[model samples]
Target: MLLSFRGAQHLRSWPYFYYRQKSHFDSAILLSNPRNLSQFSRAQPISARAMSTGRGALIVFEGGDRCGKTTQTQLLVQSLQSMGLKAELWRFPDRTTPTGKMIDSYLSSRSEVDDAAIHLLFSANRWEKRAAMLRALREGTTLVVDRYSYSGVAFTASKGIPSLSISWCKAPEEGLPAPDLLLYLELGAEDAAARGGFGSERYETLDMQQAVRRQFESLRDGSWTVVDAARPRDAVHEEVKAHAVEAVRRCAEGLEPLRALWSREPLA
Candidate 1:
C-alpha cells in the first residue's frame, strides 16, 4: 500500500482522507533489503491489535544525521512484519506533500524561508496527515516514524536565533501524535561526520548537527531510550527489536489518549 497522500489542501479540510486512504506496504516493498532484513525468517502471530484499546504503538527514532536511522527503521519494520505484526514506516519532511515540498526546497537550499516560517511548515507537514496517522494507530498498525517532534525542536532550536526559542519551536507540535517510545539513536557529532560526512542540506553540517545534538540531549527524559547507534547494525537491531516489542505491548495494553509533546507530567 502506498502510504503517501496527495492534495494537501483537501487533506486539511476533509477528515475523510484519514479513513478513506488506510493502506499498508506490500511485502516486496517491506522486505526489499534482504541484506538487513533477511535475518528474520520466522513469522509469529503478533496481532495488529496489540494494544488493549486495539491501537498500534507510535515508535519514533531520532538522532543526528548519518546515525543510520533510515536503515534501522526499515530493518525494524521488516522484523515486525516477519513476526506477523502490522507495522508501517513514516518519515517527516515526507517531501511528497505540498508543505513537505516547501520544506524540501529550504533543506536543499533551493529556496530560502524565514526560520520560524520553515519550522511551522515542517510541523504543518505532519499536521496535514494527523488523521491518517491516527487511523492507522487506532486500527492496530504500529507506526515506526523516522523523525518526530524532537527533530522539529532540535534542529530549529539549534539555530540559537533569539526569536526562535525552544518553547516557540515546540509550541506548534504540541498536539501531534506522541510516541509510545522515543528512541534516540545516540551518535556523537564527530562520529556522525566520520560515518559518511554531512549531506548538502541546510542542517547537515557538522556545526549544525553538533548544535542539534545538544538540543536533543536537553529534551531527554524518562520517556526516551538512548540507544548506542555506533553498534553494528545487527546489534542495534537486536536492541531496537526488544524495545519495540515492549513498547507495542504497552500501547496494546491500554495507553492514554495521545497528548501534546512534553505535556505529560515531567520526568522525575
Candidate 2:
C-alpha cells in the first residue's frame, strides 16, 4: 500500500513517537553478501503471532556511512522472509522524491547551502516518506530501514553546530513512527576510513563522522544494541541475527511503545 502525505509540518509529537506499549515477535533471518543473500536458507512458520493481528515487526539498521549497514539490513530481510515473514527494506534520502533530489544535490556538493538548511532538508526527506512508512508498519510487513531519523540528527549535529545537542537536533523528528528494535553497528572511525571515506557526499568526513558516532551513543534509548563492526561480515551478521531475534520477541511481548522517535519541534 502507498500513502501520499506531504508538506513541512511534523505530524506527531515526541512523547507519542517515543513511548507506547506493543508486543514483539520472535523470528530471525540471516544474510551473506549483498547480492548473495542466499547463503542461508530456512523457512519457519508464521506460526508465531502476539495478539493475532499478524502484523510484521518494524526493525531498523542504523550506523555510520561505511558500517556495512546495507549488507546487514539485506541479510535481516532475507532471514525474515525465509522465516515466512513478509519484510521490506528502505533507504533514506530516497533520492526518488523531489525533496530527496534537493538533499542529493547538497550531499553531492552540486549545490551550496548553509549546513543548517541542509540538515532540515534531510529531516524533510524523512517527513515526506512518513505516510508510506506508517502504512508499511500497519500492513503486516517487516520493515527494515537502512537509515532513519537517527542518522538525520547524528550526522547534522556532528557538523559542529553550536547549541545543537542531540535532543535539540532530534526534536524535529519526534512523533515519527518508532521502531521495535534499532541495531546500531559500532565501529571506529578509522576502520570506516579504511573501508572508504566520504563518497563524494557532504557530511562524510572522518572528523565529522567521528562526532556523529558520539552523538549516536548519547541518543540511544533502551531498544538499541551496539555490535562490533570491526570483524568479518559473517561474524557481524551472526551477532546481529541473535540480537534481532531477541528484539523481535520483545516487540511481541508488548514492549513499551516508542513514545515517538521523530518530531518537528522548532529548534530550541
Candidate 3:
C-alpha cells in the first residue's frame, strides 16, 4: 500500500531523529576518512541556488540473507531513474574496498577474526563511505541501499557474543546517515533457505537467520515499513515504489538535514 505524504512526514518525525550527543569515538571515527576531512575543509554555507534544489533522500533496504534486498534495491533505483529522479544502488560489505576485503575474507571463511573485531570492521567499512554518501544526498542523488547499518548490527548481534550487546553493536554505527525510509523484506526462514544459493553464505544457517530476524524486529521503529516478500515480485515492487516515490516527493519539497544513525531515543 502507498504511504501517504502526511504519513511519510509523521514517519520522519519518529523518535529515531532525536539527536544524541556524539561520543568521542563517534567524533574520531567520522574524521578518520580523509575524504570526510577534505569535504569539511572545503564546505561552505548553502547558497540560495543550492537551497532552491532540494537534496535526495536516503532509502535503505534491510533483511536477512536471501530476502531479495539486492533485487528490490535494483528495481527501485531503476524505477526512480526512469521517472527521471537521480538514484543509485549501493550495498554494504562492499567487498571491493580495502576494509571490505578483510570483511569478505572473514565472511568467506578464508580468514578468521574475533567477533568484536569483525563487527568493528563492518562499521568502519560504512564510515569510509560516509563522505560520499553525504555528498550524493546533498547533490540531489537518491541512494537506494541494500543491507545497511541494520544488517551490520543485526548480523553481529545475532552471534550472541556476551560483549557485543545490541547497544555495543549500535555504538560504532552512530553518526552515519539515517535512512529516510527503511523497507524491510520479510520472509520465512524456511522459504528463504528454499530459494536458490542460500547455503553458500556464511550466515545462511537456519538458526543464525532466525536469530538475525529477531534482532531486526528489535531494531524496527516507526521509520520501518515491512514488505511481505513472499508475494509476487511485481506486487512487492509496487509497494516499494509507492513508498519511495512519496519519500522522494517529501525530500524535494524541503530536504531535511541528514540525521545520524541511532542518534535519537528510539520509540518506546
lDDT of 2 by residue, 1-268 (tens): 1111232123121111111123433333333333322222221223354423444566888888888998999987787666555678888988989988888887888988777777778888888988777676555666788998888888878877787766777778776777777889988887887785445566777887889898888788766877888888887877676555545545444453433664323221
Query: lDDT per residue, candidate 3, 1-268, as tens digits?
Result: 1112234334334322111123211000112223223222322222223324878889999998998888889998887776556899999978999999999998888899989999999999999999999999888889999989999999999998888999999999888888989999999888899999998868889999999999999999887999999987876776787677667656755645667788753211
**Candidate 1: deviation at residue 95, Å?**
0.6
Runs with alpha carbons beyond 4 Å of true place in candidate 3? 1-52, 264-268
Q: How well is each residue in 1-268 modelled by candidate 1, as lDDT tens digits?
A: 1223354433343322111113442222122223333232222223333432466888999999999999999999998777656899999979999999889989889999988899999999999889898889888889999998889999999999999998898899876777888889999899988876477678888899999999998988888998999988977887787678667756665644555567764211
Q: What stretches of model 2 exceed 4 Å from their correct place?
A: 1-52, 250-259, 262-268
lDDT of 3 at 67: 88
Q: lDDT of each model, Cα atoms only? A: 0.76, 0.67, 0.76
- Against the correct fold, how does model 1 do in TM-score? 0.79
Report the poorest 10 consecutive residues by lDDT, candidate 3: 24-33
* Candidate with more favorable, higher lDDT: 2 or 3: 3
Alpha-carbon lDDT of model 1: 0.76
Candidate 1 versus truth, CA RMSD in Å, comes to 12.8
Tell me the lDDT of candidate 2: 0.67
